[model samples]
Target: MKNTKKLYYLIGILVLVLLVWMVNDTFTQPGVDDLEMEFQEVAVYRNENNTGPIKRIYAVVVSDTLWHEMEQYGKLMPHTKYGNTQVYFFEDIANAPEKINAQSPYFDASLNPFCIGKYEKKAMGEEHFSKYPFR
Candidate 1:
């Protein structure tokens, strides 16, 4: 009888935890339409200034992610200083060059350096993800 009571308590706790998790998820996950890139420029900022709309970010250092040949808010992968990279996304510039896909590890060639003029520090900031000041 004691064992059965313990089992019931465990099950009840599990259900409570699940309910909490579901409620949290419902509040956190953004809608699919809000994530669409057609009307947004995604960014991962790194720092902030005291008197500006500026925020530094662990920008993808890859040359192709930043070029002068692509349009404003062109899509490219966001990278971090820790060697992790996010999905390809549109930066906040139109004229930036599109990043070319890797051909082969042994046959690689260097692309051009990043051009600061091609992007804004704040892309589709809060408009895209209100939780993260990405605009």
Candidate 2:
């Protein structure tokens, strides 16, 4: 009887700890609206095949150049195991590409000069974020 009571006490403590963690995580996570910078999504692309590695790409336009906010936006993007995610940031909507694909040069060459930043997450989980004047 004593052992059973001790086990119950341990389980109750574990449950309490889990509840606390869940609440804290739910409240502290950042959402798109939580960002201070103003931006608009122009385009998004995701491959159809789900059995293997997936690819996701996004193109957005921002009111101003804020590298930190761009990085934050990239991090907020959804990712999958053994998948690739990319984000292209532009300063003007007219210059932003309306469509993007999983190709190496994701957007049209004509739009290159207009791109302000780029973010990429490789299949192996490595992340790269670069400001344009891309080299």
Best-fitting candidate, measured by lDDT? 2
**Model 2, runs deviating above 4 Å:** 1-21, 133-135
* Count of residue pairs whose backbone atoms collide, per candidate: 18, 0
C-alpha lDDT of candidate 2 relative to the true structure: 0.89
Best by TM-score: 2
Candidate 2: tens digits of C-alpha lDDT, residues 1-135:
999999999999999999999999999989878888987989999999889989998999988898998888888899999998988999999888888867867788899999999888898889888999454
Q: How close is candidate 1 to the true structure, as a TM-score?
A: 0.25
TM-score of each: 0.25, 0.82
Superposed model 1: Cα runs more than 4 Å off: 31-135
